[model samples]
Target: MIKSGITDSRSFPAVSIHGDLVITGGGLSGVCCAITAARQGLKVVLVQDRPVLGGNASSEVRLWILGATSHMGNNNRWAREGGVVDEILVENTYRNPEGNPVIFDMVLLDKVVKETNITLLLNTAVYAVDKKDMATIQSLHAFCSQNQTTYTLTAPLFCDASGDGVVGFLSGAAFRMGAESQEEFGEKFAPSAVYGELLGHSLYFYSKDTGKPVVFTPPDFALKDITKIPRFKTFNAQESGCKLWWIEYGGRRDTVHDTEEIKWELWKVVYGVWDYIKNSGNFPEAATLTLEWVGAIPGKRESRRFEGDYMMTQQDIVEQRWHEDAVAFGGWSVDLHPADGVFSEKPGCNQWHSKGIYQIPYRSLYSKNIHNLFLGGRIISASHVAFASTRVMATAAYVSQAAGMAAALCIEKNILPADIFNQYHIPSLQQRLLKTGQYIPGLVLQDEQDLVGKAVISASSELLLTAFPGATQVTPLTLSVAQLLPLDKGTVPSFTFQADAQENTVLEVALRSSSKPGNYTPDITLATQHIPVHPGHNVLEIQFPVELETAAYVFITFMKNPLVALHVTEKRVTGILSVFNSVNKAVSNYGRQTPPEDIGMEAFEFWCPQRRPGGQNIAVQCDAGIHRFKAANISNGIDRPTHQPNAWVADWNDPQPQLILTWSQPQQIRYIDLFLDADYDHPMESVLMTHPENVMPFCVRNYRIKDAAGNILADKKDNYQTHNRIYFAALVTTDRLIIELEHPSATVPAAVFAVRCYGGEVGQQL
Candidate 1:
């Protein structure tokens, strides 16, 4: 480690280029392995040939990451690990609210490189593997395109995530290709025949945003192909938040062998399809879309794979069978395109059918013949029938993360890749998985210890299931009483009740409400019918048929639109930033071209230190020199901000701009994070440094801060760089705090930052 006093400014690598785990292929699987290993605090080197991450889904290629979330209509269930897959959800859910491809790729790259334990090599490809006996991969030789250099990596465990089982093939691992007869895997979708052909690949494109038109040019052919117009409607000229273009599936031919040709053909169809639409005057709104992504990537739907200890079959997926060491799940169906799908005689017969979530055994990920090697993504051991159920991005991510985590564990234990699975500690290792918010729905433990335990309903319809060390069932309890009152049951639930006749005319009962403050609700009601009934934790939601009298303290309950969008902008600040839109109840996240159609889960979130025992707020963050409180246009102020979370702003000036904060934590929070700038041009409220009533006296020197009582609280010089941040500590709870800032110059109008609260601090664990 560099000495703090050295003061030398230089970037350094985290691990040796050669280590105990050499993961080949930079696709989703390889990236997942890199992420999982890093999170486990293991040294991992992630190599990728592409300049940017995300393989086929990268902005450079332009494909939405369709994970298992859409498995109902297709064959795409992937069972493996959830660590990396969940990270995608977490990152996209918050960072790129619009699901921007540029941001998505950036996020993937950042997650891989930012891990202190990971060494990420971009624009590099593993050319060959040096083996120490056939059972182990000794070193991998890789060439970096940009640097014009070669690098070698040595790892005890190696994962092939090239999406085509490239590592296994290069290492001489046993592999298989081509479709098998239906009897081989007992699959309804699999023909009773074997075929040399493969499923087709799609070249996806989309518009920049809605409400904009860009004249599109068609193919170079003199005459247009008008005969095949309706055949493309289900996928073409459709618009919702944004429009998609040229969503064509081609390449019924050998995908890998014809990758380059497929990409070119896909593009030709792209312009040709648009031309047909423009000339025919079909899709009156045809010109309103732009070709944002021309699908430059060749996503091979079928390819080479290492034969694993267990070859996953259609039966396993159909039965949802979980192995003792099961790490992933799948649900996409067996969707085999006709061998000549590009010129099929029949429509839709090009797509075979199978449905329901399927289970993927962990053994399917590693090579049965190759000792140290593992595979992920479309390259894993799946008979064509089972591969159909695992090809989606989500399932791929799950499998990749599991392989990565297993690799890391193997590196640490100095064991072979198969050792982890064979050991009894698999459950504990899986426990490491569950703690990170990944779900193992059908995990069957070899240790006879079960993770399923008492399930409790979270304030919102969220579930807070507890993991019982070893238990069978943990049902959620629901409030199922027909009537309960001081006179009816034991005693009426005592509390001051307020009813708004104008808002919620019908009184309704609620299951539970979040204690996250600002989220409290008097009229929040969750319908009992819709909420799944967990055995033990169901909150009864009974609603009154008619409006309740003002005098009648409600018997039932209801969920009403918040008078205004209410959320804690910053959990660590001492002031408030309000957004009360007169037009709508919610605030649209600006900057994001794609706004969510629904509110609710898309609700805003903030981070701060956790509350301490004395009921005292944890910290206070504020802007110092020149910052003001301004509410741009927040719904004409129907109500004033109350129980307001505070905010801090950074000056537009100063060689170093910062929003200074100070707090005392006796403990920590689960996670600490901050909301990024959404770029709402007309922000409802600018962040401010309010003078609190019980303010602490503090002194400032240059940029350093000191408590009036003479204790060093917080400081800022030119040392810290800033974009926007709410610093916090995990497992650390703070007490009273003081916040200040420095608006260095006039060019910097009052720096605007908002929503600050005091709570335990945490970071993005996902």
Candidate 2:
């Protein structure tokens, strides 16, 4: 091609990031696939037509992010567990600040960029495919709307995460759309015979506050019927409620051809449905509720089900069978929109799942005839019957992650996508999935050494793995991501670790399983952590205090899904960010920092305040109330309850995750102490150490502590123990302090009831 004289500033028409794997479409499934592949150490390229990332659930659309968490016993999909789906849930919780959507979008979008490993190209539409044959999809051509440019992309493996299965169709890969006859896939949800009708797409919206109610008028044919949406003789005979009514007949009418027309129809349906909600008087406030959004992009429930090596039928889902090659899990129902085009063939078309969730086989994720091509999102190898449940965004995320990881593997190993199927690489894929924080019960990290790869960047110089700085005998420290540590509040505690050296290196750190005893896989879970150490460390931080019933095994494994995890993460730094003074555990360095220490430091101390001590500042009248630190009594170590007892300020407290006394000083503090003694004459004298053993103490200096309060003093730590106990002690200074605790934290629960000065003094906190 000769260079046209249309001199432009563009360096290149479209430059592919040249990832080992390439995924077209940056929607939920596509994002998952991209991230999964990147995490596995493969270069990944993801292109999306939309400006935003999420296809179904985005702030642009105001769609809710739903998961398997429900107390009402709503039936859930089994294969929906773990993987990208779980990661979203964990993020959604933090995003719903004010328990609302504004924050959710901020977090969700951030996560898409932060969590996954794929290079994302937004506002790029894939126009054509360059597939040589079923086994080899050479390249994809796309037109970028942003700068009005055309480009080509090539990869060893390809994933079609577009809800419509656009690439699958363009590539000449076998695919099916619409509903099948009941006999076709043996899906009870399917029509008795085939027809052009479909279950009509949705145009979901959201609203919270006041705004002018918008109005919409249906077209001449808007009266076309559906079970939920009926045509009335009143107007153009159009009544709205989930209006996919006329959406039947995409067989001869391609979904892409009908996209714009369907998009318009969806708008009418959305406004019409909301009109009913307002006029019906079901919700008076809804009248003022703003039309935050209508599903901007019409989400196709049924599109191309690519024929993989194995096809998962509704029977497999209903039977709750386990496939040796299962990569993702899901459970919603076998919902087939009436293929007859009758919107309301039956009052309700959904066939509720027998259980909340089901295991989805791995074979369905890849093309049977195509070698290096995998499919994620809703277009997997299931017939119309099982897809209704599988089509949801959460389930699709998990599947996409798997597909992305598998695609990455294919690119790296020069293997075809077919080889990444259930029997061949299912275990490896499962392990990889877990590395991205997707969890499956049966799958374990096969090899700790083999699990290391790209996500874990090696460190340049020697840095402590502890949160802050130097470590002392008494400091209780958590994760050590170089200079990053869990903050007291506000921003979520997450950071990316970079390998110090240029050459590839595996990240490694010393970790201990803190799960409690007698529980299923330990409940207190930590945020999904990635290490660029020599090996991947794949396992939840399951913590358990004494009196707690369960704990996960102290497993230290590697991730297998995203193969780049083989490099694992390393926690090493060149210089110290802060120093702690162990002598008096105080804010000596808060004003100025000059490294307040000699080679052998002593008495440099700081104190984190405890409640109402010296019988002043604060007081609790009741003996019944207990200390509830956020990490203390946790369901999964995050959400803590709020209290409003005017006299005493009560922050959300749980006994375990432990109260952080971050110390950012200029020197190392080795001798710090906590004063834990019951107020004998206090009003609630009876409440003396209901669980004294909760008061486990440790020493932390400059390189170890996470605070600038100097240093905290406690003889030793009691990690996880079972005992109804009370705490009563004082921090004492000694040249060389030693205790019989023998690092007791391992066997004892971590709890600290009250921190005051030695004797009856309440000055600085402990």
Candidate 3:
């Protein structure tokens, strides 16, 4: 290599790249957006300022990703965000069950690089925006410190997902940084000035045990007195990394311009806390522990929120309001933190949950001022109160996926972003998102192009819910537990349960259901029974004197009784679960949420499911079987369970389960999409928590597709994902198709949510 002579001035190498869509962040939201657009035939350029993707989820920050499921702490059933984000999360669970942050980084990188249509720029920060006109961005100018080069990225559509809305700021997009007044949006839960108008930044640290004593020397900048932190007493030797999410700072100051100051303050807090843990002699167990990693950057919570066509508010979330142009959904509680962060005497956070998942409209995704600009992640147009719920990584990714799809439609129709809704294209957009496994609340796929609608579907056997065989396991009734059963409009069925009582006691049993059919709140009590139990064994007969007018999920609740233990079954099925009315400290669930009357938050009990290796169903037997799982449900257009069990579940006793689809005439078929069960109730946190199993227990591990002549078209093995798309080498003309499936486990039944067939050109698998 030849060295150039020093001159008065020198410039770094300049490069220009062009694409159909340009995304300005590499967080989960931006990564999902890029992948979605790229799959929909749009050339995408993903520009990330950091060395790795996942932003706060990367090893540098190490915050676990959470969304609607809220660690399975609320009533939102089967509520995980789908599409590209689901794929990433599912894949991460399959490959990285240990949830190592560094492994998560590799998963994101692998997904982005696999998409040929996506051009990813790592360690590149966008500094300048070039406008084609007053309201449209023509290109962006970015500099990569590692490469020492400047890049000019040009695209017709741009998505600003940077944590601080960097592109939106440079492009003059209208944005709000602080919380709005209570009167501005009529938000009763809006924070007052004393409580702080903005959320703060958080830094995390990890510690390791060396089996021997380790010395810790405090830095000059380390905080001297840990007592200054009000909640310092709550810290313990076992809690490290994101478990100490309360260690936050820099909310009173400008979060964007003063990020460095905020990070330094957070650093001081972390080092000082560690100093107290290691040198304070308070934690004897931490004597052999050493600092493994400390976050280099703080995880930002609130920043500049760019304005779009519509702004989501508190009422939209609390009321679970429906949107005409709904594209995404959010279910996390409205969680807010104090501006003083760790130093404040106030509690760590204020979280208020809604009864059900709320729909996000398409109007809140694009910048109103900048014509070609799309706002994503925490920067999406939403009031401060609403942003608290939508700011989570999974929800952000779900919303960003919609924006990416809208961008693709813009290119295909040669129209602007707003024109998509104005021209009655929202239905088409919704269908496309559904095809890719994106779940919009209360929406079902209605694609007329799918040939499955024209076929008569039949299954070898359908599950008749009569009983869940009891195993050797028996769980104590420490907290109230309920068995969720989907029932039709009729008299409640008589159920029998096997229970063991330590002493003679009266076991209170109640039948309940959600006021809203689609939700799982279990707020309305239908009937109650006080059953007298014996000391050793009891076969309790539960009969409710109630009749239902409509079909819904009824909850058979057995109230908390320390003296009783109920039998639990190992048998797992689709659209069925056992929930408990208890506290999940991780999500702020405290048995029942009793918010202030004027806060505009609902007061209800939290009925949530437990995770695997323990969340077994309660053993029950019924006189009349509930036949809800029908063969025709495979073509019902709904992918996940909603108000009813919208799935075809085979009986557990069926030796070889199969589904056959027969048409009137021979038709050319090239593609088939199978939607299976992936246990959506599990939160599947991206990092810091280990999952029990790599594959979801309800997914079909092996399946085969055969044509009319019994020739195998596709044979899939060890499938763990929810969406399975099969493409044939060429078009095959057949009047009938048979799908043979193997259950994921002997105890779990084989279930399918939907099966869609299409006649199209064969393409590479996505």
Report the C-alpha lDDT of model 3 over 466-540, residue by residue, as the tens digit.
998545578999989999988889898899999999888999999999987588999999999999989998888
Off by over 4 Å in 1: 1-16, 71-82, 192-197, 208-230, 233-236, 239-251, 287-292, 345-358, 442-766
lDDT of 1 by residue, 1-766 (tens): 7756666585332233755566666666677777777777667777888898878667665555545433112212112223455445444434554556677787787777777877878898777778898766777877887877788788767878877665677789988777767666655556433333466665655545457767766648422563553456554465411123123344355566677777776666666765665666767766676655555675556667568878887667655565787776665444455554434444433222222345566788888877888887777887876776687666787877777777766766777666777776566666555444344554322212211111110110111111111212211111111111101111122222222222312223343312222221112332222222222222222222332221111112222332211111111111221111111101111211121332101122111111111111111111111122222111111111122211223322334433322333332323222221221111111001111211111111124322334354445443211112334343433332233344332312222222123333244433
Off by over 4 Å in 3: 470-472, 762-766
Give residue 674's error in model 3 in angstroms: 1.1
- Lowest lDDT 10-residue stretch of candidate 1: 680-689
Question: Which candidate number has the best TM-score?
Answer: 3
Cα lDDT listed for each candidate: 0.46, 0.44, 0.92
Residue 755 in candidate 3, Cα distance off native in Å: 0.9
Give Cα distance to truth, residue 90, candidate 1, Å.
1.7
Better of 1 and 2 by lDDT: 1
Ranking by lDDT: 3, 1, 2
Count clashing residue pairs in model 2.
155
Cα lDDT for residue 760, model 2?
Answer: 27
Q: Rank the candidates by TM-score, best first.
A: 3, 1, 2
Worst 10 residues of 3 by lDDT: 757-766
